[model samples]
Each structure stands twice: as structure tokens, then as C-alpha cells.
Target: MNPRLLLAIYLAITLAPLGLSAFSGRPARSLWDELASGAGMLAYAIILAEFLLSGRFRSISRRIGMDVTMRFHQLFARSALVFALLHPFLYRAPSKPPYPWDTTRQLTLTDDLSAIASGVAAWLLLTPLVLQAIGRDRLDMRYEVWRLMHGLGAAAVAALLLHHTLAAGRYSADPVLAAVWIGLFAIALASLLSIYLVKPVLKRMRPWVVDSVRPVAARTWEVTLAPRGHGGLRYLAGQFAWLNIGHGPASLFENPFSISSAPAAGNRVAFIIKELGDFTRTVGRIRPGTPAYLDAPHGHLCVAGRDEPGIALIAGGVGIAPLLGILRQLRLDRDPRPTLLAYGNRVAEQIVCRDEIDDLARHHGTRVIHALQEPPPGWTGHSGMLDAAFFRDHLADPGMREWLFVICGPPAMMDAAETALIGLGVPARQIICERFRYD
Candidate 1:
């Protein structure tokens, strides 16, 4: 479904509890007390819904793009945190046992100690959980370790919130709301199990073996994997996967990388990896025949059904991985749409697959423009960043405005390219882009 429909569904799910509680026929409490309950219920709903937004479910991410899905996950998490933090402070009712005559507890908040403790624990844990996510890159921890901690921590908070809500919440005494809370909590836990348990088991059954690992450009390596038994991954071009090589399926060592190989190029898949740190730094040492696993085809960067008269590809540095797959697929299909590639790098040596790129322009009638920040002596390509000026100078044709534009690169460059395309009159629908980082 489209993003608007997805968003509507999300709103319906998250607001269901509040809507139910509002109409549950319970005697109304003080305004502050009602706001407190509403805040707590809304926060819990958003938190549970977060489980499904973890960027693993293809059904949710396929239409919105994984990056956009993740962006939603992060933003909703912060909003939930705010509501949770304010829940306690918003209450105006006294924290005491319900009077014998006040059986409904409308005059006093629930005084159940265990329920109160659970709420406080969840409240405390949530702050650190959100902080760690926000400052993930600044922390001195392995990504794998962080992932495990995050999953366990979130599960703990969810459990605590469920117990606190069922025991202390006024509206939750109603059977329907209680069931809703339990159902949501169960779905959250099930989502965790599917990601951390079920998917690994499936990966083990259909494994891949390393076919080759070789340096392709400055600090970049091209790694290929061939299916050991089953048919290889069937994915559209310009998509990515979480790759785990020389590690068990259960391990958290997997890192996401784009497929540089065309889907039409047999079953073996290729990744263009630029080493920055962590798992990537060891890409060059991976040997042939090592075991590999893929959780793949996760991005909405493909142009499969687009009917634009032409295709424009923009890339910066190793970000060209997915774009290269698009270019190769187009060539293999003998697509008649005119193509343009504007690839940029910091230096000449950083340019990858130079010969193949040249061949596309020389033999396939593609318009290829290369840009370099620091050019060598007598360099003929454009000698500057691929900024607004570069796009304006090379891509101002009115016909180009109607063409489909796909861009992947450094965050800044991608933003500039997107803005420039819009400034040049390209419809937002015709431009496809995905960021590797949500922040």
C-alpha cells in the first residue's frame, strides 16, 4: 500500500486503546488523572507498535522504503518516551488505596505496590534505551552487542508496561482493553522471535558460499556469494541485503550492503563494500568458500515498473553499488529508455569499475558524466562536487524533468541532488532515493 494508507493503519492501531478507554463507561476522574492514563496508554501502544517497525518486515518497508520506515521508528520512539516520562507527573489524584465505597477507584489512584514498581522500572529503562539509540555511534560498543542489548531492553520494558497497565490502569479492568493490551504485547514478542529466532533457522537451510573477494577501488572490495543449494535470491535491481559471511546465521555480525550484481547475471550475488570500520574492515580477508547468509532485497530503490522515457542515475563514491545493479539490469534487458549516469568520487582512484562504466557509454549509448573533487593533471571530467550547480549545468533539459531519477551517495550529496531535481521541476514521485543512515 501507499505511505498514506500505511500511516492511516498505523494511526488506527496506536490510537485504538485510547479510543476504547474513552468510551468504556467508567466514571470519569479528574482531568489530570485522565490525561495521565491517556499518556500511559498511548505510550504503551506506540512502544508495542515499534516492534513491527524494526525494518525487518518487508510488507511494511517495501512501499515506504526501509530508510523511511526506520525514520518513523526512531521518531515514534522519541514521542513515546516523552509520553511515558510525563505520565506520572500528570496525575492529580492521590496515590492511595481505593476507599471501600469508591470501588471504581475514581477518587484515588491504584496503590498496588508491585504495579507501581513495574511502571517505575519501565519508566527508568526507557530513557536509557532511547539515549543509547540516539547516541549509538558515539558509544564504544560493537554493533552486535548493542543490537542484543537493545532487543532485550525493549522486551523488558514492554513486559513491565503490560503488567503495570493491567494491574494499575482504571480502564484496563474492562475485559476488552485487557485483551487488547495482551494481544499487542504478544504480537510484539512474536515479532522479536521472528527476527532473532525464526529467520536465522531459515537462513541456515538455504545458505550461500563465498565465491570471490577482491579489491575493486580505493578501500573498496567486491564480494560475491553463490547459493549452495537452492535458487539464489530473487530481488529487483537497486536493492540491498544484510550480509553475514563466515558466521553462523544466529550471529549478529551481519551488515547491510547493496547488490552490485544485476539480477539477470545468474544466481551469484555481488556486493560493493567500502571499508570504514567494524565488520567492513575485514572484507578483504574473507576467503572463497566461506559460508554466507543474506536477509535481502529490503529497499524500494528499484525502477521495475516505472514508465519514464529515460532513467537518470546519480552516485557518489561506493554508493554506486545499487545504481550499478540498475545500470547492468537495464543493459541486460536491452531497455530502450535513454540512460544517464552522473557518478562522482573524491579522487580518480576511488572511481570503481571504470572500464565497465566507460563501456556503457561507448557501446550502449548512455550519457556518462564523471565528477572528481581532486582531479589528476589533464583530467577531462568535471572537477568539482556534484552539487546543485553540477546538476543544473548537465541536467537542465526539460525532457529530463520527466525522466525517473535514482540517487544513492553521501548523505549531503543525495540531499543536494534531490533538492536540485525538484528545483529543476522533476516531480517528487519520479525521484527515488534511500539513505543508509536514518540520523
Candidate 2:
């Protein structure tokens, strides 16, 4: 079945109970109500699971089908807070006075205590999410600081949510609902604990030795790692792995980087690191043979299942990292489908993997179009940004729409390329892009 259709079906199944509630005249009492409540709990649990398991915000956002996952997270979290607040008010029992006014007064008076605690927790979680969404550029918190705050705030919310759930156990009275809620909590806790504790313990027990580190460019370096004794992870092209360059997992500094090599080659992996900030700037200086731990082979950006007759890759800056992996995989797989790459860089000197790209064009029948924003005096390649005119001129058959356009770039560049492709009559389904922005 089509993945989108399957997702739709799954969502419908998960939300069917809530949909039926609007039509039901009586208050929730039957098995159907229990089922609906159970499903809702399960959905919330799934959301938490997806968030905690993700290595980065971008990955979580994509998993949840949003351009910015944090925005959706804030919206959903606030909505959950509202639902949680109203839950008791709508279902509380009457007081001894037996008067409706008395019951209302009693609920209003006591609800604030539980509501305030959960509200505070929800606000703590929502504040960072909203700030990150709106002030990503302005709030210059270090990555480590931001990560610590995010994790701690999430834990606070989870603990408060647990308290709220247990305090009002009506929802948990139904075994199915209780089980789903507890199961979700357990999964999220276990996933986080595994990442924070178990994985680190194992890494300490067995670690990989960094074989060598070679400077590739002014600020970029290529780090080659080999498993100490056991073979390393088996990964596909366009997939990323998390790296921790320390003795124990307690270091609290782990980042995801794409594997710049073909997957067919085993036991060793190469990561092309560019020093954009503090974490990466020190990468090259790490001593050779230092112990490193990697948790890897993640990401859905690959051309393995794509059967399009032609492929067009649009890349900008370091976004070309994954595309390099894809190209290498295509070569290793011996797939000769016509591939066109429109790689854009600010200047000629910044064009990464220039030699490899040119070599691919020469040997694999691929065509590479280099778009330089500011060409030097002696430059002869295409100049200016990639727009509608560029696509109209270079694409072999613009009207065919049989080509798969794979775009990876800065958010603005990706948006522009997508719009230009759409304006040129490419169907939405035929265009594929990856968003790597974390904030």
C-alpha cells in the first residue's frame, strides 16, 4: 500500500473513538468510550515516543509530518494541557450538598490545585518550544545548554503528567486505557534511559578507536573511525549516525553526522565535518586512536526504492553531504539511470566534493551543473542562483515530469527550488526534499 494512504488509515483507526464521541448523546460509559479514551492516550504516548527517540528536532518534525516539529509540538502540548485541565471539571462527582451549584463550586475550587501544577509543567515545556520556534536565530544558547534545558523541561512535564494521570484515575479505570497510557510512558522512559544510561554503559564496555583524522578543507576535516575489535555499523547511503568522542557516554556531547562514504564498504566510516561552531571546531584536534561510540544508520533519505527514469539533485552548501552518499551508492549499485546535479555554492572555492562530482559525471554518465553565486574573473561555469530559467534551460524534457527531483539545501533554497519546480509544472508527488533545519 502507498505509505501516505497507510498513514491515513492508521490515523483514522487511532482517532475513530473521539470522532464517534461527538455523536453520542450519553456520557461516556460503554466499552466504546473506554476504547476511545484508550486510543487517545496511546496517541499521546506515540507523540512522546517519537520525540524522545529522535536524535534531532528536524528528524522528529519530519516523522510527525511538519516543516518545523517544535511548532507542532508546542501547539499539541498546549492542546493536551487544555484537555487535561477540562477533563476533571467535566467528569467530577457531585458533593454532599447534592446541589448542582455546590458541585460546580467544589470542582472549581479543587481543580485549580491540580490544574496549576500541570499548567506550570506544560508552560515550562511550551516556553522553550515557542522560544526556539520564534527566536532560533536570536536566542544564541549553546547547543549543549539548549539540549539540557529541553531534556530537563520534558522530564518535568512527564512527571507532572504522570501525577495528573494517577490523581484522576477514572480514565485509568478501564484496563485498556490504563494499559495504553502506562505502555506509552514505559516506552518513552525506556527509550530515554537506554540512550542516557544503557547505551553509555555499553559504549564504555566496548568502544571504537578513531583510526585517523585528515583535514579536508580550511574548516572541514574527514574523521576516519574503525571498530576496535568488532566490525562497525552497516549503514545505507544518505543515512546519519550519532557520534560521541569521549571515554564514557556521560560526556553529554553527541551529535549526528551523515556518512560520506558508500555503504558497500564496511568496518570503517568517514564523516566530513565542517567547523560551524564550537563542537565541530574541536573535532579535528581530537587525538588519533581516541575511543568513539557511534549509534547510527538512521534517516529515510535514500534512492534505493525510487524507480524514476531520471533524477535531478538540487543541493546548496553542506546540504550536498547526503547527496554525495546517494551518488556513491548509485555508482556502487551500478545503476545507470540518468542523473543531473545542480550544485550551488556562494563561490567557486566553496564548492565541496568538486573533483568527485566531476569524476562522477565523466565515469557514470551523470551531468553536473555548478551554479556559483559569485564567480571569480576566470570562472567559466554557470553563474547566478538556480531559478525557473535554469531548470527550463537544462532539463532534457521539462514537460515529461518523469524525473524525480531530489532537493537538499538551506530552507530558503529548498523552498525556492520547490516553488520553481512547481511553477515549471512538476507534480508535487514527483518532487522529494529533505529539511535539515533543527530549530
Candidate 3:
């Protein structure tokens, strides 16, 4: 589906509760009271939607890019936190039991102890939940442990919110509105189950075994996996997968990495991973024939269906992994489109598969440009950062406006390259890119 249409659907789903509340036909309360209720409803709705967004649903992530999906998940979580925090404080009505004359509780807010307790619990849990996610890297915790805590914490908050809303909300007393809340909450739980239980079971049925693990560049290793008893992953050139090696299928020790091997290179899948995280640091030691499981083919950094006249690939350090997949596929298919690769690294040793990249230039007619920040003596390639000036010097061509530009790299390098490419007259829509970080 189109990204814009997906966004529109998201807007509708998030705002549905607000719209439903407006037409509930209840006695109108003060602006503050209504705003408080609306905020609470909006917050809970967004929180429920967060589950689906983070559930790794290919339908959503594949269409909008997993980076964008995860980004929305984080931002929406923060927004829900703000709304939930302000929900109680915004109420202007006095907290008291319902009087005989005021059956609709118009003159007073419900002082139900259990309802308020649940709401308070959810509110308190939300702040630290979002804060921990935003600063997850700084926390002295394992990635798998943090992921477990985050998931359980979110589920608890959702349950508390559901109880608080149905028990205390003015509009939620209505059957239609109450059903909506219940339905959304159920869907959220289902999404969680699908990820943690269903997908793992499916992956367990189709296991893979490690084929090889070897050094590709500085602090980087290439790990290959071949299907144990079935055909392997069917994926595009630049997609990624969550790989769990030498672990149970249901384990949370997996890490996402781009598929560096070409799709045309048979069923054996490969990943180019750098030594960054705990699991990644052990990639060098992963022995051949170790059992592995993959949750794969998730990403939008592919250009298979595009009609661009030419292709330009910009990569930084290990970010060259996915671009290598794309280049290799193009070569295997004997693509006639002009190709250019601008690969930048701090040192020449950091360049992965340098001979293969150069071979693409020598044998396949790819225009390869290498940039080294700390270049060795007598180096001939660019000797500075890949900024706008570097792009203008090497990428200034009349036909480039219609070409497709694919970039994968560090955040700083991707940002600079994007800005430079746009400034150099490359249309933003024609530029395909994906980030590794969500926060």
C-alpha cells in the first residue's frame, strides 16, 4: 500500500475514539473535563496501536519502511505518555459519589477507588516505560532483558488502561464505545502473541544451519546460513532479518542485520555484521553448522520494480552491506543501467570485500569511488568527508536527476549524503534509504 494511505488509515484509527466520544449524547461537561477525557482516550488508543507498530508486522513495516514504523512507534509512545500524565490533572469536577438528583454523574466525577488506582498505576508506569526505551542504550542491561521488560511493562499498562477506561470513563459506559475499547485492547494482545509465540513456532519448523563465518572487514564478520530441511528465505536485495544463532527458536537473543548476499545467489543467506552489540561481538566465533533461526525479509530498501535509468549507491563503513547485495544482484542479472558506488570509510581496512567492489568496477563497468577520512599515504581516492562538496565534485551529471540513489550507512553519513543529494537535484522520492536506529 502507499505510505500516504497507510498514514491516513493510522490517523483515522487513532482519532476514532475522540470522534465516538463527541457523539455519545451525554450531558456536556466543562472544556477541561472534556479535554481530559479526550486525552485519556487518545492516549490509550495510541498505546494500543503501539503494540501493532512494534509487532514487526511485515504489512505495515514493508510498505512504510521498518525505520519509519519503529520511529512512529517511539514517537507515539511519548505522545501517549504526555496525554496519560495530564489526564487526571485536567479534570475540573469534584470527586464524589453520585447523588440521587444527578444520575448521569454530571455534577461530580466518579471517586471509585479501584478505577482511580488502575489509572494511577498506568500513568506511573508510562513515564519510566518511555524513558527507559528512549535511553535503552545507556541502561546497564542486556538487550534481550530490556526487550522482555519493555514488552511486559507495556502489556500491564494496556490492561490497566482498559480497566480504568471502562470503569470510569463517561462515554465508555455506552455499549458501542465500550466495545471499541475492548476490541482494540484484544487486538493489541493478539499482536504481541503473534510475535512472541506464533512467529517463533513457525521459525522452529523451518530451521537453518550456519554455513560459514569469516572476517569481511575491520571488526566485521560474514555469517552464512543455509536452510536445514527446506528452501531458504525469499527476499529482495536490501532487506534484513532477525537472526538467532545457537539459541532456541523462542529466544530473545536475536539481532537484526542486513542480508549482504544477493537474492540470485541461491537459498543460502548471508549477513555482514559489525562487532557492536553483545551478540554481534561473538559473530566471529560462530562455528559452521550451528543451528539458527531467521525472522527475515523485512525492509523497504529495495529497487527491483523501479524504472530509474541509472543507479547510484552511497555507503559508509559497514553500511555497505546492503548495497553490496543490490550491486551483486544487478551484476548477476546483467543489468544495463549505469551504476556508481561512493563508499566512505575512516580507513581502507574498514572497507569490506574491497576486491569484489573493485571487480565490479573492472569487470561490470560500475563507477566506483572510494573515500577515506584517514587515508593512507599515496591514496588516490577522495581524502575528505562525503559532504555536499564531495557529491558536487563527483556526482554532478545531467542524467543523475532521473537515476535512483540508494544509501545505507551511519546516521551522520546518511544525513549528509541525503542533504547533498537533494541539493544536487536528485528527487527525494527517487532516493531509497533506511536507518538502523529507531530513537
Best TM-score among the predictions, by candidate number = 1
Compare the candidates by lDDT and give the number of the best one.
1
Encode model 2's per-residue lDDT on 255-278: one tens digit a residue.
Answer: 777777788766788787788886
User: What is the C-alpha lDDT profile of model 3 across 7-126, one tens digit per residue?
Assistant: 887788789889998888888989999899989999999999899889988889998799999999989999999988888999999999988998777778999999989999999999
Which pairs clash in the backbone of model 3?
A: none
Comparing 1 and 2 by lDDT, which wins?
A: 1
RMSD in Å for all candidates: 0.8, 5.4, 1.0
Please give the lDDT score at residue 239 for candidate 1.
94
lDDT of each: 0.94, 0.65, 0.92
Error of 2 at 25 (Å): 12
Query: What range of 10 consecutive residues in model 1 has the weakest lDDT sum?
Result: 55-64
| Cα lDDT for residue 397, candidate 2 | 71
- Which segments of candidate 3 are over 4 A away from where they belong? none
